[model samples]
Target: MIKNSTKVLVLCALALSLFNCSSDDDNDRGNWIERSVFDGVPRSNVVGFVIDELGYMGTGYDGDDYLVDFWQYNIAGDYWVQKADFPGTERSSATGFALDGLGYLGTGYDGVDELTDFWSYNPGSNSWTQKADFLGGVRQAAIGFGISGTGYIGTGYDGDNDRKDFYKYDPTSDTWSELVGFGGEKRRFGTTFTIGDKVYIGTGVSNGLYKTDFWEFDPSTEVFTSKLDLDEEDDYSITRSNAVGFTVDGLGYIVSGYNGGVLNSTWEYDPGTDEWEDITGLEGYSRQDALAFSTGTRAFVLLGRSGSLYLDDNYELFPQEDYDDED
Candidate 1:
């Protein structure tokens, strides 16, 4: 029989062990650390592109009005500064990409109608210049990325129908041209992340159905190859739209989006194995329409909305670190 003091000591040891185990379980995978809050109005569906380590974001709808205000984030310094306002009509859900050291933005909804006008930003002068409009007709919630010095935009809603078509923008010629052979289903709010030479595209909704098919686009060969479906694994819960995708240290991640409701779940994809692993999710409110900035070594997610609540908070991901809520 154990004495009361001995029982007390044993109980304390057991409690400590359990506490350590719980903490370990909580932090075994990825972790999110809160960062500096965004300085601009809290908004969602904002467009952004990275140029020389600086992230340029603009033209999103605050709950009350469409916004054309633009801001720049210095990734290394972890701060934001206002830039010249987007010279075009105020809009949200636009797409933007950086090509040849310049950033390009276009094609979104201006609250009343979908827009096709495109514009370019010159960081050197901190100014905006008009470019040829998007050739793919009016669209919003499309995917945009730059590869091998060229920019591509594809998959979104055009007023009445979801579109699967793609178009390439040649900054050298200041023109847009069609690129076919994307056999994926028509979608809107799809997400993409580039890993080395290939860009992976998936997720979105079409006709009220959440899409699961995934594909890889090789800009070098200009071919789309089917990849593992997002639902291939019995435990995979990666089918989400309006999420943000980014690559860090060669691994791709998709985080925070809406399915039937807002989500904070995060998933990491290994292109080499063609598999995804669940990871620690965003530590903030579950949100959709968030934006991500990947500086190759680090990634940050910021400025999205939950239901009617707009968010201006930001968080940086530590893919292999232990979770610490206190930051």
Candidate 2:
């Protein structure tokens, strides 16, 4: 029965348990870290999203009016909660995402009209549901991303033109279907993310220059592959358009804003190798139309407008890896 020296000691304990489980999966795939602060109350173009470690901001503009208010940030309790308010129409460069677990807001420019209207926030039912309107450019520095489960909006700038149409939004047939327009130039604000199902978009500003152009959408070959020209890190000054972008753990950040007012710095991109580094010994809150988001890996830069004031703050970025359990 079992006696070849106990089956060679049970095959040497299952080959040392599959070599220590791949040596802890190559020692946990390390190298990826960065952190920053300053996010107390600096409202600009805010509108956030991040379900899981929680991170949800709301409404924007405080230099005068425009701000329906709503907040909640507990990225491990760096704390900030004032949720509920922004149900629909109460604008500021609108656009937020998180389908499935619910959270959608759209278009922007309520400084009058440019709000293609779209709402759906149910942080477990705090309430708000209108959905399916932003088929593209309701206007206001637009640029959205949410792949796979679908929700791709595109380019913005509609006070005098500058938009490249590219809608998707298939909230289980809630509507919106235009895809394939954003080729660049008809711009507005910038930064988008998705990665696996392809979504990319990169630093922006159109007509007057300052665009690190970089497209990549591919909702199953809906096509949009450009890849690079992300202005090669010219250290963004103000090719302005209400900047805001997020993505951690896999790298990609673009904080603060105002090109005409002279950026506040905080750049860092690295789609594995697209590169755009600058973040080193940095700070925070020097914003512009803020409202960034990311899930567990962390990223949040809520509230904006730093030049003439108008903020409510909510910064929380987090990601610092250093693996090598003996690699």
The top-ranked prediction according to lDDT is 1
lDDT of 1 by residue, 187-251 (tens): 99999999988999999999888899999999998999999999999999999889999999999
Assess candidate 2 and give its lDDT: 0.68
User: Mind giving the per-residue lDDT tens digits that candidate 2 earns over 46-86?
Assistant: 67777766777778776667777777677775766787898
Q: Looking at model 2, which ten-residue stretch has the lowest summed lDDT?
A: 28-37
Cα deviation at 99, candidate 2, in Å, is 29
**lDDT score, candidate 2, position 105:** 76
Evaluate residue 198 in candidate 1 and report its C-alpha lDDT on the 0 to 100 scale: 93
TM-score of each candidate structure, all chains considered together: 0.95, 0.34
